[model samples]
Target: MNWKNTTRQTLGTTVLCLAALAATAASAATQQMVSVKGSTLNMRSGPGTHTEVLWELKRGYPLKVLARKGRWLQVIDFEKDRGWVARSLTGSTPHHVVKSRVANMRSGPGTQHRIVGKVEYGEVLRTREKRADWVRVERDSGKIGWIAKRLLWGW
Candidate 1:
């Protein structure tokens, strides 16, 4: 029998399987939002509700999915905090959260534009557009304005 040939073929198959798994994991690195049901999403230390709650994420908060278990997603925020959230409570909508102490919302994409409003830390805003380093954002009240991308996090 061709023992060496069989071993070589098995090794090649193993490499291909690993590559496919790597690609799947890369694609799983998607941004998702906590579904807005007039409540907060509990990020837990483990995949189950029996685990300790690490944090409570509000609606519109953006999270990067790092891994997934049965019905739960291992997620990380703009602050680099990691936790597990129920997959059913997340959505595909694009959003951003204010990471700085305060973010100035302007009428235009640059600082020369008029200041339209202000958003504080932990506040979440829907992503509207991007111009240079400025990101146009919309508040829950339907107001639209631009903020410097450096002052916020998420897509």
Candidate 2:
């Protein structure tokens, strides 16, 4: 084979390899939602101007993007429910959950305080801190409160 012809073939092959690598890198750069904030987000059946509403998502909601088409994103929520939504409405904050049955979350640390909420087993809880047996938690709508230490998983 001529040296000049061999050099051109090698250069062409290298360019193709580099192009494939760049495409893979670009695919991996898309941002993922670490958590969901606010009261709730609406999930729609399809992307864009016309779609049916499927479900509502509360705070600390988690989702994985399956694909993206223009300004809309196809995702699977924490419940593994698949749907589409506007890409600008999601966030990336960490979340946790309660690990015990009938966990009492109170207004204060001591048992003397009023019971503010009752967290069931496997219920998700956003953690803040711990004071003795109390674990501070933040609700999906930004409600700050405390729960018993025996009630949570991430503590």
Candidate 3:
């Protein structure tokens, strides 16, 4: 209840808050997204073709690039599946994967809009534009709509 103690507590709280914000910003700035460029891109345990294949990612599959080797890149997907892929098989196209079991693709950026299509879990959609918490997405079939950002995990 003394002035000194109150000021010290306030300063400690301020420092902790600033530290948290800095960490968040740093991580956000470092994160980069890339998409699978081929029909089937093999994700390996190591950064080369000789390594064990961990997953077969389809074209447009969004991956968070974590690190890079000579000709390969370490990546993680929406499901937290981590592996290495060839840099040539990836591109800078932005995309998102449905993290939820299912998400409604709406005509607009809110629930008020009519549902145009349904997106399934692990399904990748090309990112078009962002409006508030909703993102405009394009299905591979050529259908375009808006989906709530909370239901997706990607760029």
Best-fitting candidate, measured by TM-score?
3
Instruction: Give one digit per residue, the lDDT tens place, for model 1 in 104-149.
Output: 9999999999999999998999999987899999999999999999
Model 2 regions lying over 4 Å from their true place: 29-31, 96-122, 125-155
Please report, as a residue range, the 10-residue window in candidate 3 with the lowest summed lDDT.
25-34
lDDT of 2 by residue, 23-114 (tens): 88767644354345566777899996478889876766656677888888888754557898777776655555665657777888878988
Ranking by lDDT: 3, 1, 2
lDDT of each: 0.87, 0.72, 0.92
- RMSD (CA, Å), candidate 1 to true, equals 4.2
Question: What residue runs in model 1 are displaced by over 4 Å at the alpha carbon?
Answer: 1-38
TM-score to true structure, per model: 0.78, 0.54, 0.81
Candidate 3 lDDT, tens digit per residue, 1-155? Answer: 99999999999999999999998976874498899988989999999889999988999999998887899888898888999999999999899999999999999999999999999998989999998899999998999999999999887
Better of 1 and 2 by lDDT: 1
Candidate with better lDDT, 1 vs 3: 3
